[model samples]
Target: MVATIHVPVLVREVLSMLVVRPNGNYLDATFGGGGHTRAILENISESARLLAIDRDPDAIERGKQLAAEDSRVEVVQASFDQIADVSRRNGFEQFDGILFDVGVSSDQLENGRRGFSFQKNGPLDMRMDPTDGKPASEWLNTASVQSIATVLRKFGDERNARLIANAIVRARPLSETQELVELIDRVCKTQEVNKHVATRTFQAIRIHVNDELTQLRQGLRNAFELIGHAGRIAVITFHSLEHRTVRRQFSQWVDSSIPARMPIRGPNKGPMKIVERGLAPKRQETERNPRARSAMLQVVERVQ
Candidate 1:
């Protein structure tokens, strides 16, 4: 099998924001294709340890190979929401830095068997970890029309979510990628320029199947708990939903206000400090990689 080429988005920005220390430990929370993990290892000192985590078994296997080549690297098979537990089990009480490259991996999308892409006719399985959780087809086939429409509207921002959901409900038991794609296309007659008509529906179903938003919210909380004082947290989000979650989390961490009902309160000091506002990929990088066009980077440092 030919190796999937995954160019890590915003490499330069991620590295610069991370501020790698020679002897500091780091965590690559989403070790998709091991692009960010590899870069971290290359830049950090040999004495510094880097733990890479991923939900996909295939990615974990690939990460194991990378770990084999370097004694300083350790790969774990787990979601980012399990970061605190995974880190503690791995002998890391706290990390000097953590990186989250949120969203689907290129390997999952390019490979039809993974079922993350509507461009390919494959099984409608969109699970990050194929071993667990119900597949997208199961959810779509069994979920209520209202539930399906809600997912489409909330996650995908689809304007014709009801129409699409109604069409899907009328045609139950969708098992293939193209079947759902065709159904959405028939119901939603208009298409965005340079984008597929089924893009939003596909995104909505995948998000619902994987529970991505919940995972993201939990992962951010776990990351904040595990990062040491002065340590940095860098997140690269590809969509508005992901970005908004990160933004809100950072804002809460940086807010100095305490609820009036709280009995015990420390000095009005926030636990985190914002490092930068929303940063986008440069024109050159976007031109080279169209996927980078929608990418946004956010950074924060734990102050307490």
Candidate 2:
């Protein structure tokens, strides 16, 4: 078997915050390369069980192989947003802990064919699940300038959203990754130190193509409902958008306010409590894996 080069970011910190329990049942909601799943299996007892879920078919295949080797692991092919349904169908009503390592995985980024890397030339297909949804190229070629600008501003936080969007619309029918990169490089001046000129555009496109933010919101809600009392949920997000969503959701849970709707009506105060302030990678980890630099981990425990 070929080895997976994907090193899970902040593995040690994630494990520490997860507080794996012997014989406990857990869920690895993102199960990218099974790094976190393997660690959990090692730390827990033989009686412990873990349910690994991933939307990517390739990831599911890898997860199935991993599960075949260990009786305690069960791999499911589904998005993390469907956690509640997947777990229910799998006979797990509540999980002792749930973990989400959001954003694109290393495997996706490194594989040029996946079209996630701006440095590598490839087709403009950025869907996490290549089997479905509109490819980035298709959307980029057909989407209006205003729509493209909106995505860049909302998802990528690109300062030159209008300029980049105009350029992209003008250069429609972009079929390759390099084409888009070159266009962005020509249109936007990169002032951010150590960041690529195409970074924001690529990020914006990928997030939009994958419907990531919406999925994350749903996943968080489902995960909270499915966690057992005293169980914890840890999320590692790489960008401001994701981190903001998690922070708001966690705050709502802590404050027991439904937000924009009527206050949570019940004797129950809330199901979640923040375990700690947002945590970032230490100098050592970031030095080893630069990708870990932007990662922010936040943990919350479910309480009655």
RMSD of each: 4.3, 4.0
Write candidate 1's Cα lDDT for 182-218 as tens digits. 8888888778999899888888888888899999999
**Candidate 1 local distance difference test against the native:** 0.87
Q: Which ten residues in a row have the lowest lDDT in candidate 1?
A: 255-264
Model 1 misplaced stretches (Cα beyond 4 Å): 256-268
lDDT of 2 at 233: 91
Q: lDDT score, residue 295, model 2? A: 94
- Cα error of candidate 1 at position 183, Å: 0.8
